[model samples]
Target chain A: MKGSLSDSTKRVMDIKNRKWLIAGGVVGLFLLASKLLQAVELTLPRVPLADGVDVAIEWATINLAPFFDGIKLVVIKLLVAITAFFDWVPWIVWVVAVGGAAFRWLGIRTAVFFLAGLLTIVSVGLWDHAMSTIALVSTSMVLILVTGIPIGIMASRNDRFESALRPVLDAMQTMPSFVYLIPVIFLLGSGKVPAVLATMIYATPPAIRLTNLALRQVSPEIKEAARSFGATPFQMLFKVELPLAVATIMAGVNQSLMMAISMVVIASLIGAGGLGNDVLFAMSRVRVGDGFEAGLAILVLAIVVDRSTQALGQRASKETRTE
Target chain B: MAQEGAPKLSVRGLWKVFGHESTGGIVPDEIANKSKEDMREDDGAVLALKDVSFDVNEGETFVVMGLSGSGKSTLVRTLVRLIEPSYGQIIVDGDDILQYSEKELVDFRRRKTSMVFQHFGLLPHRSVLENAAWGLEVQNIPKAKRLQIARETLDLVGLSGWEDYRPGALSGGMQQRVGLARAIAADADILLMDEPFSGLDPLIRRDMQGELIRLQEHLHKTLIFITHDLAEALKLGTHIAIMRDGVVIQIGTGEEILEAPADDYVAEFVQDVRRTTVVTVRTIMDQPDLKLRQSTTPAVAMREMGQAGVVSAFVCDEEDHYLGMVSFNGAAEAKQRGDATIADAITVDEYPTLPADTSVESALPVVLEHHNEGALAVTDEEGVLVGTLLPSSVVGAMAQEAQDATDHREASAASLEASHADDQEEADGDGDSEAVDPREGMEVS
Candidate 1:
C-alpha cells in the first residue's frame, strides 16, 4: 500500500516538475527575446513630485502664515513659561522635587543616583543648560503623548487605520531628522517651534507603535471574558484593554523620552538653546573638554528619565501580576 | 426528569460552517446535504456544526459530550452568540435570539446568560473580588452594591477569604472557582460552561466537579455544559447529548445512552464506560419464581418448593412484605419435625436484602457473598418483595452486554464493507481500496 502511494505521489511530482520547467522556459525565452530587441531602448520618465511638494509647502507658508504664527506663539510661550519656571526655582528645589519623586516611585538607589547626577550638572556649571534641555524635552513629550497615544488607541481598534498609518510611521522613523526641519523651517521658521515640532516628529512613532502592539497583545481570552459579561466597547477598552496595556505603553513613553533627548543637540541647530548649544559651541571652537562636559550632562538626564520610566512600567506590571 | 412546562432554551437546525462560502451566506442545500468530509474536500469549508439541535429544560444540567474537534465547544459558544451561527434559530423564552438587534442582543447577553470558559478567563489585573464583580460592573452597577453581591457570590463558591487576592495568585481549581463565581454573580437564567475543569489536574478536576454539583443543588440554574470526557458527562449531566463529527448522534439519560447507544460511533465512544455504575438493580432484577405465605404448613411448603423445582422459597406475610427464604431441605426437616407452619422454618438471618434501586456495582459483592443461600430478595422502598437477584442474573446482564457489543462490531464490519463496495462503484473500479481497510480493521477489533 505504501509503495503504491509513493508511486502515485512521484507521478504527481513529475507532472508538477514538468509544469514548472515549461513556465521557466517560457520566461527565459521572453527575457532572451527582450535582450535581442534591446536596440529599441526604453527610457524612464520623471514625475517631479519633489517640485510639487516644494510648491505645496510654499503655498501653505504664504497662505497660512497667521495660523502657523498662532501655533508658533503658543508653543514659544509654553516653552518660555516652562523655562522660566525652571530658571526661577533654585537648583536645590529642583533637586529636592525630582529626587523626592524618584525616591517614591523607584527607591533609594535611583533617588541617590538622580541627586548625584543633578549635583554633577550644577558642579559642571551647566545647570541652566540642563534645565533648558529638560524643559524643551518635557514640553515636546507632553505634546507627543497627548496626540500619539490617542492615535495609537484608534489604530489598535481598526485594522484599516493601522494599515494606513503604518507607512506614515515608517517614514517618520526612517527619514533623516533633518528632513523634518525643511518643512517645519519653511512653515513655522526655525526657532523653539520648529525644534519642538522636529523633536515630536522624531519621538512620536515609538509611543504610537508600542501602544498599538500592547493593546493588541492584551490576551484574546481576557477580551472575550470582558465581552461575555456584556461590557460596552468603551468599558472594555478602559477597564480591560487599557489597564492591561499600560505597562507596555509606559515602555513606549520611555522610548519617546529617550528619543526626545537624542534630538536635543539636533534641535540646537534650530536655536532651541540648551546643553546641545553648549556641545555645538564646543565643537565649533574645537574644545573637546567642553563637549565632554555637555555630553555628560545629556547622558545624566537620559539615565534619570530612562530609569524612572522603566521603574514605573515594572510597577504597573507587578501590580497586575500580584495585586 | 423534571421536564415540566416549556423548555427554558431551545435550539433548532443550528449550523456553523467555519469557512462557509455559499452565496448570500445562507447554507446551501448541496453543502448541507453533503457529508462533513465531502464538504471539506469539495469546498474547503469546515463543517464545525451540522444541523445541531437540542432543548435544555429549566435547572437541567444538559451536558454535550464528544471527543476533541467534535464541536462541543462550538455548540456552547454558539449558545451565547460568541460564534455566530451560520444558520438557525436559538429560541430563549419565546424569543428567537438570532433575530435580536445589536442593542437587544447586548441586553440579552447581559441579563439572560453567562458563560464560563475552559481557560478560566479572569482578568489578571483585577482582584478576585473585582473579577467576580466584573459582570455587574459592566452593567453600570454602583461599586458598593456590586462588591456586596460579589462578596456573596465568592462566598457561595467557597472563596470568601481570598476575595482580595489576584487571580494569578490562586491555584488552577481556585481560579476556576473565581470563574464560576464571576458567572454566577451575573445571576442570569442560564449558565454556559465550556470544559471549565478540563485544564485542572485530575484530583482538582474531581473536586471542582463535586463543587459544581453542590452549587447546582443550591442554585438550580439551568446549565449547558460541554466536555470531551464521557465520564465527566455521566457524572454531572442530568441528560447528555453525544456528538461526533459536528453532529449530535444521540441525546438521552446516562443509563439510556449506556444501554442502547444510537449508532456504532456512539457505541464505540461508550465502550469503555463501566456499566455497573450506571446500570441499576431494578433494571436487572427478575420476578421471583416461587412465593409462600408464612402461615402455610411445612408439608405444604415442602410440596410447593418441590413443585416449583427450586431449592428455596421466599416467604412473605399476608401483606406481601418479605419474611425470609425457606429452603426445601429446611421445609422437609420441618415437616418431619411436625412444625405447624413454614413461619417457624423460614429464617431471615442468612442473606441481606437489597433495595430495588440499588446500583449493580453496589449490589455485586452482596450478591456474590450470599447467592449460595438463595437469590437475594430485591425489595421496594416499602420492603415489599418486588423481584429477585441471583449470581446468574448479574452474569447474564453483563454477558448480554458483551454479546451485544460483539454483535454491534460484526454489524459495523458488514456495513463498512458495504460502504466500501459502494465507494468502489462510485470511483468506477479505481484500485484505491486500501484507504477503507484501516477503518474495517478498527470496527472488527
Candidate 2:
C-alpha cells in the first residue's frame, strides 16, 4: 500500500506541471460547451411550481377556512391589544421609557442613541408610526420566544426531532422575508394580523435553532452531576439545564428581536400600520423627504433594539462565566 | 440510619454494562476473560462493573482505588445509581436500595447519601454559598435556613470568608472544597467522593487530603472515597479496595495493603508508594532478651554479650531509660582489671540512637551505615528503651513484606475462584431473565 518516496515525489511533480494545462482544458471545455449551447439557442424552461403552490393555497383557503379563522381571531386580539397599549402611551412617555430601558441594559451610549433616534422620529412626524412598529416587533418577539423555546426543548431531547427541524429552519431563513406574506395573506388576508404572522414566521427560526443548540451544548458532566445530586427530570431542566443555557438562549432571543425589527418594513405590504406603512406610502407617491424620514425612523428603531438586546445577552453570558 | 449494628453501606454482586439490551442478560465465558474493550465488542456491552462487592463501615473512610479505566469511578458512581448498574443490590442502613421505587429512590438520594464529583460539580452560575446550599435547595428547605446551613458548611470546609465568591472564581482545591461542602451540607449519612482532588496540583492535592482526614474526624460521615493515587488512598483510607477491570482485587486496611499486595497489578501500582516514608521503626523493632542492667558486673555483661554472639550490648538503668552501650571487649577488660560494674566500663558514645516512630525505610539506612557498635536502640518519648532495631531485622521486614504479598496472592486467587463460581451460578439462574418468572409464564401465555 505504500508508495515509494521517489514515486510519490514524481506524482507530485507531474501534477504541478500539468495543473496549468488542466486549468486551461477545464476553461476550454466550459467555453466550448457554452458555445454549443448558444448555437442550440439557450432558453429558459417553464415550470408549474408556483401554480402548484397557488392551487394548494386555494384549496387550503376553502377547506381550512374555519381553522385559519380561529387562528386569525387569536392573532387579531393579541395584535390589537399590543397596538392599543402602545398607542395609549404618550410620545414623551415612549421616549423616556425606551431610553431608560436602553440605559439600564446597554449603558449610556445606546441610551443617548435611543433618545436621539426617538426624538428624530417625533421631529420627522413619524412618532405614531414608530410606536405602532415597536408594538408589532415586541409582540412578535414575545410570540417567537413563547412558541420557539418549547419546540427547541423538544428537539434538544430527541435527535430525530432536531434533525427534522434543521432543514425547515434553514428554508425559513433562506426564503425571502416578503414571500412569507403570500401564505399570511392567503390565510388571514391583508392586515396587521397577517403582517404579525408574516413577521413571526420569518423571525422564529433563529430562536428555535439557537434554543435547541443551547440545551444540546449543555455539558453532560454537569447534567450527570445534577441527576446524581437527586434532581428530578423537571427539576434538572428548570434548575441546572436552563440556568446553564440562559446566556445562549438570551442570545437567541436577541437574534429573534433583531429579525422581528428587520421585518417591520416588509410587514407593511399587507397594510400593517407602522413606519413601514409610512415608507411604503411615501415611496408610492415618490415623496423623497417623507420616505427618507420613515426609512431613517426604521433604521433608528432597529439599531436601538438590536444594541440593547445584544448588550443584555453579553451581560448575561459574562455573569454566567464569572459566577 | 442511626442503628449501631448495620454497616453504613454494602454493595453486592454489582455489575454495570453499558450498551443496548440485546446482550443485557447474557455474558459469554471467553468474553469474561477478555479485556473491557474486547468484551464490549464481543457482547456489545462495556462492562463498567463486574461482581464489585465491598463493605463500608459506619463513620469510616473506605477508599476504592484503581487507575484510569479501572472502573473505580464507575464503582463509586454506581453506588449512588448515577450510572445505574445492570445488576446489583446496594444496601444502606439495612435497606436494599436497588428495589427503591421512583419516589423512594429520590427520597433515598435526598435523604441518605450525597456525592462529591471528580470535576467539582459546583453549579457554574451559583456562588460558593449557593453551590454548598444546592443539596438543601433540592431538598426544598427554606431559603434562609438553607443559606444559614450553607454558610456554616462553607466555614467547616475552611471557606468562611469566601462564601460569597463564585465557585468558578476559586482555585481548584477550593472549588473541590466547595464540592465537598455541598455534600456535607446535605447532612446525608454517607458521602461518595469520586477523585475529588485529582485536578489539583500535588501540594494542593496533599493539602486537600489532609483537610479531608481532618474533616472526616469531626463529620464522621461514612465516606466511599475513590482515587487512583496510591499515596492518597494509603493516607486517608481506613480500609481500601483495589480494583482492576471492574473487579475488586483486594480489600484491606492501609498497612495490610502495604504489607501484602493481592496481585501484580496492585504490586506494580504500590511499587512507587514510598513504603519507607510510611512504615515506622515501631513495626520492625524487636525485643531481645539480652538487655543488660547498669548494675550488672562487667564479667557478667561480657558473659551475656559473648553468649548472644559477639558485640556490644545495650546497658540501661533499672527503669529502662537508655544510658549507654557496653561492648564485649570493654566488659572483658573490665573483668580482667576486676572492675565491679558494667556502668563504669560502658561505651555511651559509641552507639547511635533512633526514635521509636522513625520510618523503618529511612531508619534502616541510618542503622546500616552506623550499627558497627551494636543494634540501634529505639527509645520512646520518655527516653525509655522500647526495643532494638537490627540490620537483619530491617532486611527481614522487607522479606516479610514480600512473603505477605505471596500469601495475599494465594488468598486472592482462592477468593477469585470462589467469586467466579458464584458468578457462574448467578449467570445460569439469571440467564435471559424475562420480566415474568417461569412459574408465572403459564399465566402470561
Candidate 3:
C-alpha cells in the first residue's frame, strides 16, 4: 500500500481530481447518451408518481382521513389548550419562566439575555405570533419525544431495524421541507394541521437519531457491572442505561425543537398561522420590515429554547461529573 | 464445616478456547498436546485455558498467579461464568454452576458471589453511596435501607466522608475502594477479585493489598484473586495455583513453592521473589531445643543450655507453654545468689520474640538486631513455644534459594551453549551429520 501511494504530490492530486472526475463523467455520459439517441425525451421521468401519490392520498383522505382528523383534533386541541394558557399568561410571566429557568440552569447572563429577547419580541408586536409558534414547537417536541424515544430504543436493540431506518431517516431530513407539505396537504388540506404535520416530519428524525446514539454510547463497562450485580435487563435499562444517557437524549430534544421552529416557517406555506405565517406573508410580498420583525422573533425564540435546553443538558452532565 | 467438607469452588476439566468454534462432539486432538501458537496457526483458535482444574476452600484466599495470557484471568472469570468455559464443570456449594439457568445464574450472582473489577467499574453518574447500593437495589431492597447498608459498607472501606460524591470525583485508589465497598455491600459469601490492584501504582497497590488482607481478616469470605505478582500471591494466599501457558504448573503455599518448585517453569517464575518476605516464620522455624520447665532448677537450666551449646533455655509451663527465656549466665548467677527455680532467674521478653505466623522478612531485623543472643523464639497465639528462628537459618534459607535458581539458570544456559557449539562443529565438519530442521529448509546440505 505504501509503495503504491508513496509520493505526497501524487496522492493529493489523485484526491483533488477524484471529485471532478465523478462530476465530469456523469455530465459527459448524459450528453453522450442524449446525443446518440434518435428521439430524446427530456421530460423528467415522473413515472406517474404524482398521479399515483394523488390517488393513494385521495383514498387515504377519503377513507382513513377521519382517523387522522380525530388525531388532528386531539393534537390541535392540546396545542390550542396550551396556546390559550400561554396567551392568558401575561408577557411578564414568560419573562420569569424563561429567565428563572435560565438563571438556575445557565447563569445570570443568559437569564438577562432571555429577558431582553422576550421584551424585544413583545415590543415588536409579534408577541401573539411568537406565543403561537411556541405552542406549535412545544407540542411537536412533546409528540416527537413520546414517539421517537420508544422507536429509538427498539431500533437500538435491533441492528437490522436500525439499519433499515437509517436511510429512511436520512431521506426524511434531506428531502426538501416543501416536499413534506405536498403529501401532508393531500391528507389534511391547507391548514395548521398539515403545517404542524410537516414540521413534525422535519423535526422527528433528530430525536430518534440522538436517542439511539445516546443509548448506544452508554459505557459498556457500566452495563456489564450492572449485569454482574444481577440487575434484570429491565432494571438495567431503566436504572443504569437511561440515567446515564439522559444528557445525550436532552441534546437530541434541543435539536428537535430547533428543527421544529425552523421547519415551522416553511410549515406556514400550508396555511399555518403563527410568527411563521408572518415570515411567509412577508416573503411573498417582499415586506422587508415585517419579515425582519417575524424573523427576529424566531431568532429570539431559538436562542431562548436552544440555550435553555443546552444549559439543561450541560447541567445534568456536569452535576454528575463535578465536585 | 463447609471448609472441611466440600470446597467453596471446585472446577474440573475447565477449558476456554477463544476464537474457536467447536461444533463437533470431540475437541480437536491437536489441542490436547500442541502449543497455543500451533493451534492458532493451524486452526485459528486460541486455547485460552487447557484442561484447568482447581479447588478453592471456603474462607480461604485462593490466588491464581500467572503471567499475561496464562489463563489465570480466564479461570477466575469462569468461576462466575463472566467468561463462559467451552467445556467444564464449576461446582459451587456442590451445585454445578455450568448447568445453572439464566435465572439461576442471576440468582447465583445475586446471592452467592460478587466480583471486584480491575478497572473500578462504578457507575460514573451515581454517587458513591448509590454505586455501592446498586447491587442491593437490584435485589429490590427499599431505598432507605439499602443506603443505610451502603453507607456502612462505605465506612468499612474508609470512604464514609465521600458517600455523596460521584465516582469520577474520587481518586483511583478511593474509587477502587468504592468498587470493593459495592461488592461487600451485597454481602456475598464469595469474592472474585480480578487483578483489582494491578492498575494502581506500586505504593498504592501495596496499600490496597494490605487493606484487602486487613478486610479479609474480619470478612473471611472465599476470595479468588487473579494476579501476576508472585509476592502478592505469596502474601495473601492460603494456597496458590501458578499457571503457565493456560496450564496449572503447580499448586501450593508460597513456602511450599520455595521449598520445592514442581518444575523449571515454576522455579523460573518464583526466582525473582524475595523469599524472606514470602516465607513465613512457621515454615522456617525449627522445634525449640533449649526447653526447660519453669520449675526446673537454675543448675539444671544451665546444664540443658550447656548440652544444647547455647547460653539460654526457653522456660515453659508443664504443658509446654512458653514462659520466658532463662540465660545460662543469669541462671548461674541466680544459683550463686541462692535462687531456687529457673522461673525466678528467667529474663522476660528476651531477644525479640515473634509469632509463628509472621514472615521471616518481618522477623529478620529483630532477629539480626539481637544476632549475638540466642535465636528468636517463635510462639503461637496461645503463648506456647512452637519453634525458634535462628539468624543462621534465615540467612541459610535465603542463600540456598539464590544458589538453586542461579545454578539452574546457568546449567540451562551452558547446555544451550554446548548444543550450539556441537551443531556448529557438525555443520562445519560433515555439512549433513546433524538432523536438519524441516521448518528451516528442505535441503539437508
Q: Regarding lDDT, does 1 or 3 come out ahead?
A: 1
lDDT of each: 0.85, 0.80, 0.81
Q: Which parts of model 2 are misplaced by more than 4 Å?
A: A1-13, A17-55, A100-108, B1-6, B22-37, B40-45, B280-445
| Model 3, span A1-323: residue lDDT tens | 77776787788899989989999999999999888984865566558878897898889988997898887898788788888887899988878888898888788898888888899998989998899888888878878889899888988789999999999899989999876688777777787777777877889898899889989988876787778878887998898888888888888988889899888788777877889899988999999999998999999999888887887898778754423
Residues B1-445 of candidate 2 have per-residue lDDT tens digits of 4378767788877777786332223344554456778766677778878877888898999999876677888888777777677766788888877777778888888988899887786788878898898889888999999999999999998999998887788988888999898999999989999988776766666678778877887898998899766767777778999987778999998667877888776775555454554566777788855888999998788778788885877888999999878778888888888878988887766577788867656676677787665578898888899998888878777776667557666665565446444542432232222121222111100
TM-score rank, highest first? 3, 1, 2
The candidate 1 chain A region of ten consecutive residues with least summed lDDT is: A314-323
| A187-303: candidate 1 lDDT, tens digit per residue | 988878899999999999999999999999988988887898788788888999999999999999999999999999999998789999999999999999999999999999999
Per-prediction DockQ comes to 0.45, 0.37, 0.35
Query: What lDDT score is found at residue A310 in candidate 3?
Result: 86
**lDDT (10s digit) by residue, model 2, range A110-147:** 78988998899899888888889998887787788889
lDDT ranking, high to low: 1, 3, 2
Q: Which parts of model 1 have CA positions greater than 4 angstroms off?
A: A1-46, A64-89, A100-109, B1-4, B21-26, B34-43, B286-357, B365-392, B398-445
Question: What TM-score quantifies how close candidate 1 is to the native fold?
Answer: 0.78
Docking class of predicted structure 3: acceptable
Candidate 1 lDDT for residue B140 = 88
What TM-score does chain A reach in every model?
A: 0.83, 0.89, 0.84
Two-way TM-score contest, 1 vs 3, winner: 3
- Which lDDT tens digits does candidate 3 get at residues B1-445? 2334888888887777887653312345666677778878987888888888888888999999876667887787777777777776888888888888888998999999988887787888889999999889999999999999999999998998999888988888999999999999999999988888877766667678878988998999999998766667776788999987788989988789977999876775555565665667888788888788988888888887888998777888998787778887888888898878877887775556788877665676778788988678888888888998889888887687668657667665565346345533432232331232211211111
User: Which pairs clash (backbone N, Cα, C closer than 3 Å) in model 2?
Assistant: none
Best by lDDT: 1
